[model samples]
Target: MSEFDAIVVGAGPAGSSAAIRMANKKLNVLLVERADPPGSKNVSGGILWGNALAEIIPEWEKDIPLERLITHKGTTFLTKDSSISIDFRSTKFLENHSGYSVLRARMDNALANSARKAGAMVVTGVTVDRVAKEEGKVVGVEQDGEIITSDAVILAEGANPRVAIDSGLRKPIGDQDVAIGVKQIIRLPENTINERFNLKGSEGFAGEYVLSYLEGEAEAGGFLYTNKDTISIGAVISSSKLREDGQTHSYDIMESFVQHPHIAPLLEGGKLEEYSAHLVCEGGIDSVPRIYGDGYLIAGDAAGFSFSNGLMIQGMNYAITSGIAAADTVIEAKERGNFSSDSLASYERKLEDSYVLKDLKNFRNIDKVTWSRVTHRAIPKIAENLLYSMYHETGRPKKHLMQMILESSRDSGMSKSQLILESYRMMRRM
Candidate 1:
């Protein structure tokens, strides 16, 4: 017999949620983490979108460590010296509580504690070398030359997915499927944050910027989120783009972002509190690996359950939902006394029925839409030039909308035909 009914690797949203659900169902569970504290290794800033957490812990908002509730959102098309933004603020977002700003360390630590309270054996500061297999089926995990046996194993090892790749559970993630995310926590006064961002009470703001201003052939985007007493600013750049440009690095892009005239004032009085960098998935559905097999399953970033649709980036909620679905599958499998691949295949069905896979499949081509030169460069420049023409004061008569648009399109270095074709493609894909 196995020692534990299920073993969950990593302690982020996915692993911790899996452990909690399994433990609550009275299945002996072991949740292992490489970092001493559950989320200590994670990059500091992110948004937890959706209300998936309420499914597992109904009163989570009353206790979970969230920085602030997002009540405002903005998206900017940015050039080197100009920008045009669409900003919206709604009380509905706060009342319904759709999203919150989170620091992973506090959030993950709280989740691990919840798992412990749910009666799972939570272990930290230990690295799982690989899943222990017998007869081509995973039976447990090996760590420090020792074997810990389990009836099933759930891999929630985040974006790196070393165990999944090493164990032949999935192919190695290619550069096209990955991006580098770098973030920093800048400490600011609470009232100052409130005043600068026009926030009230627990209301927070999230803004995304297209980083067309970066030098070289780099494709990247920037984000700035308002926390209670700090600001979270970061950029996600294509790994392959970074490799092509010998001069520009992720940090250099970050430096340029924070110093931008539009972004600098909000962070003027802030002091740097923390900095972190990590790998993120950008490949949508095509990059996802085999998620379930005999006596084993994968969830969260390990299974590539992340999505970006140019306007919004969502992962944590998908992670939470995927984690819960993984646990539920194991519960059903346990009832039938089967842990075979055929039994665990229910995991995929659950994801398909849920928004996790449905949304991914629906927007699978978003990567092509957002990563294209037209979306990142030509569009932003055209927007800036057209807006500049409209707003700039001159003694001469102002040009009409069509004239300005034609001039902007000509200056953008793309033909009208190319622009129209790309716009059609974007409309169809998005």
Candidate 2:
């Protein structure tokens, strides 16, 4: 007999959140995960954006096992021997408490427990081989040669989703559609981290980076996040770019980034804690596949709800919102006794009406700026050269800032016109 009223695949932030929402509505939901526990396999440079989590767990910031609340955030450009950063700070940082730095295993497990408390079954180490379809509609999922049936199945499978692809609900994830992220948790004293990052007490820091030292062929960028007693540092490169360049692997990039002259000093006494590698959504809106199909819907990374708009990597918030939306759609579908594609299409409408799709649509052209060869490769070096030249002093006559910019552009093989044009295009589109 079909036991669960609904089945949710992959018990990460998306799946667990969806399960909690549905179970809270008195629907019997089963959340399946392949990891030994809920978040053992998930990885991210993850700083969970707030406000959405409040919908699921109001005052979540007060009680969750949050590593740190972001009080300072910025971007940096890394060179071989030095680095420069642009900082954004305000007295309002303490008031707003923007986001939280999290390790997936810790955060996801906490959320999963909340889901279980809300009356959802969270099963771990269960591999969902495929979503079962009957007469051209999803009915359940197949696990270990057994058919586990349910009225609705929400696929919250992470990036590079296999369940959606197998059921033809979505296409294969292109390498260009995804990026590879490698992160290492470096352990340090809480006080040491605060002093180094110029944060006081428990205030945390988050940052993005454009690495000029990676030799440019990798088409990658970097991010650093401060946690309670550790810092997460890593790089994210285009998946296809990595395959084609054959330049360096994730391991190599992590080592190089930590050992860089500027980064090394900050991490001087830190001990290695944990290392994790994973894939992240790089495709923005264009990569989103069919979100709703017969008796099934997709949310979170599986639906490509994640978006990186150059300046920030945003996923957890989108995942939380989309997961809630997916559950809400199923709630209405059950009320109407309809599980067809037409009914489930409401999920897409719900997301479109919300910030998830709105932001994706709003920043649709971001990849044109972030992933472009000129933007990733030349811009960082140009900024580095210009800053170094403008600041470095010697006996010779110093050049003006304009001259420094021109020289840097020439050194980076970028013309003034091209730079101006690209900057203008980014402004118009982004």
Candidate 3:
């Protein structure tokens, strides 16, 4: 911990990717993680999006721990006793696949190992206490009682960032800026999961739900992902909503969701294997802070690199892309013998040209649209009622479709005008 070309704090996807990229360029990069083995402290709902990894490392499959390749996908809207979903099941969709279901414990270790193999010195059980700076420029990291000098520092320390915040690289995240993800991994036989999800071999389905299973006091949603022999099911809620409710824990909501009519049958015979929780960035583009500064760059969740538009939740993709951009900027700075903010400003340009920032920028209003009551309450109820009217059979007089729709809307306690307005709002923003 004395001197290096760069210091990367936290060995999650962002940190490890950044380290690997720089080290591959022959830079002496030192990557440190407080978790003894890395990824031990991380939790995810699986389903990593994008194929940026293949571009970063042509042979990365050998370095990533994959649980299943996604073959079926859907998003469901759920009310207290009913649900409606839009699904796509195909073998041809991204056949080679850009996404995968993974467990962080295995994935992170493999990524960290890849960085080490790329010639970066990797250390675990090491906490970076502060960014050591002099004359208004970051020059190293402080760990324990010593300073490790470096030309620049990269912070990819997940949602709750310490060094990034303490070093003045970014502002402390607020309750509204984050969502708490509580998840449980349930174990079932591989064959059983395949049978239940209608999959063959290692193919699996991933689903996210705008659940009304829990009390409506706090707005939240749920996700379920199929691993090889286990299923990851959980819910994510705004932290401010959780605190304002102050009546139930996220785990309790997860419990109720598991016991719900639609979800219960899916996990009928499974053993609970893991229960975990973590913070997720949900504030969209506006919530993102300045990503680059003199001698410092922030990547991953620490930089608010996450997006959940109630359909697809993307984080890892942004993390990897931003990590690569950071490494590219640092490599250029080292080459130019200038580690100033001006030199690293290229990172922003790199991201602007990449899908990472473009997607975030395009969906900047997603938080407003997806977090609306339309997603969780009114829309689901409306859809459920309409479907019930269409499918329910009885020996009665047949009614016109328009009349049936009106009756369904009234039964769901929504005026036709309200439904039209909500639909229009969603269309306008999303």
Candidate 4:
């Protein structure tokens, strides 16, 4: 008999959730993490959206170390000297509590501990070399020099899925299929944060910006999230765009972002406390690989469950959803006494039935629109010029909105046809 019924790789949200679920069902589970503490190696923009966590721990909000509740969300298009933004604030966000800003190191560690409390044998500081297999069926994981055997293996090893790739469950991700994100934790007094962000108590603001100031071929966006006594700010850029630009470094982009006139004032008195960088999967649904095979299933970034639809980026919720689905699939397989490829395929069906796969599939082409010049350059320039012309009154006659639109489109170097085409693309994709 196998030592454990299932071995979960990685202890981030997905692995921990899966381990917790299976353990709660009274299955023997081993949860492994390469990092000494579960969330030490993880990085994100600091917002966990949706109600997926409640499925794992019903009163998670009461227990998790959340930074702030996200009551406002904004997106801005930026030029060198101006910006156009759409800001939305809702009391309903506070009433229903759909999202929260979180520090990964603290939140993920607590989640892993929850798995332990649910009876999972949590092991940290252990690297899983690859999934151990015999007769082309995954049996467990290989760590150090030993084979820790189990009836099944679940890969939750974040974006750099070494074990999944090595096991031939998926091919190497292409440069176009991924993104690189760099984040900074800036410390400010709680009162200072509340004042600067116009927030009260634990209410927070989350903003994403379309970056148009980069000096190369790079396509990227910047984000800022309000935390308890700190701010989480970062940029996520297309990996292929970064390579093609060759001249821009990720740090340089970050420096430029922080110093922007519109951004600088909000963080004037903050001190940099931490900096981290990591790879993020942003290829939408097309880049996702087969999630399940014989006696094995992949969850979280390992299965490319992340989604970015230009306006917002979502991954954590999808990670939790996929994790729960993977565990449920295992539970069903166990009842049937079968850990075969066909049996594990139910995981995919479960995802399809949930918002995880449905949202990804519906917005599959959004990444293309986000990476287009219309989003990064043309739109920002047009908005800046139009708004500046309208508000920056001269003694001369003021033009009507339609005439201003025409002039702005021409000034932005986009013809009528190109503008119409781009608008169509956005409509179709979004």
Off by over 4 Å in 2: 309-311, 396-398
**Winner on lDDT (3 vs 4):** 4
Task: For candidate 3, write residues 193-216 as lDDT tens digits.
Answer: 999999999898899888755564
lDDT of 1 by residue, 40-158 (tens): 99873489998898888889988799999999999987788987899999978966887899999899999999999999999999999999999999999999779999989999999
> What is each predicted model's overall lDDT from 0 to 1?
0.89, 0.84, 0.85, 0.89
Q: Which TM-score value belongs to model 4? A: 0.98
Per-residue lDDT over 310-362 for candidate 2, one digit per residue giving the tens place of the 0 to 100 score:
44688888888999999999989888988889988889889989999999999
lDDT of 4: 0.89
lDDT of 4 at 28: 96
* Model 3 misplaced stretches (Cα beyond 4 Å): 411-414
